[model samples]
Target: MSVYARRRRRSGTLMELVLTFVALGLLALLTLSGIARQSAGEPILPWIQPSSGNHLPHGVNYQIDALDPTTLAPMATLPQKGMVELRLAVTNDSALPVTFSFPTSMQCEFVARKVHTYVGGLFVLPLEVWRSSYFHNVSRHASRLTLNPAQTKVYVANWTLDPFDTGEASAGTYQVSASFGKSTIPLHIDKPL
Candidate 1:
């Protein structure tokens, strides 16, 4: 016999195979759970209404809508004062995925300016701005986002409105606008919204 003994070839242990299988199975279960939640129409959103208007861009479109603060439902009327929520939706309508580079985590900026209409619907002047939420994530870091074709991303922004703070936005008409990337959409902000 040779001085050196021939060692038996090692194979994966039973525990190793079982662990790997269990990990994969767990991952699948979690992924399916998320899919089921979305497909089952669970209350997974802050708003529960269809969009009103859409920006008909070629590649990507945007839609802005108001939502009731308490029930988190879609508000058809102008957003009311007090706690308000706006739904910002960005959709990828192109065949390929669309990517956006944001300077910060705050993907959008919102501002509502008091609309001063003189002599009925004749002269319109925008007064002091209210609910001006310019920055949410103040970080200087940049972030990149990619949306697959037919994918829509919705962001909910909350701001407390008090006519007391600025006499401009009190129980009246205002122009509420949101800016996403290079596009901006404005809607009338009235009462009982």
Candidate 2:
């Protein structure tokens, strides 16, 4: 073959290869942009709906049911063999679906603080008579639960303790509260004799 002809053929092949790469690069850019547009406002997990940041929907109803028996029964001995079921009923009142974003596997935490009379409401002893975090064994995962309109889901935790009281350790007025849904219920426990 002539040198000029051979040179022309090599140049043609080089130009074709360069043009092919440019076309592929443009195609790749278009494909990635389309995907980005589809996922603009969505989280990584599209199936799991995300709630408003750190705030539950205003219309959603999340409340603890009335405590059974309404009063703490005095314990006859220490470490009473009893249990209380803490039930949280979450209802979606809005027309749209509501999502609960739990950073941990625990949906909520129950806490009890002893209120001392010596200080006359000025001093509250930080004592937890019962805690679901220690007693409840649930699979740990950062998860989300979505509820449709008018749907209610109840989460229950079985706390092993006397109603409103655990034992000698729980004698006194307790300012009780749940970490989730935000509620406070005062409970009185008679001092053990």
Structural similarity to truth (TM-score) of each candidate: 0.59, 0.51
The 10-residue segment of model 2 with minimum total lDDT is 37-46
Residue-wise lDDT of candidate 1 within 1-193, one digit each (tens)? 4434322212346567889999999888656544443332222231343243334457887777777779987766554356778778888989998788877766677777666544333334566465445543366788778899999998777766664665434566766677676556676657642
Clashing pairs in 1: 78-193
Clashes of each: 1, 0
lDDT of 2 by residue, 1-193 (tens): 9999999999999999999999999888655544442323222233445332224567876665424333543332323335555566778999999877776777666665454432232222345566667756777678777889999987666555556553544544544445553333223334333
In model 2, pairs of residues that clash are none
Query: RMSD for each model, in Å, please?
Result: 21.6, 19.2
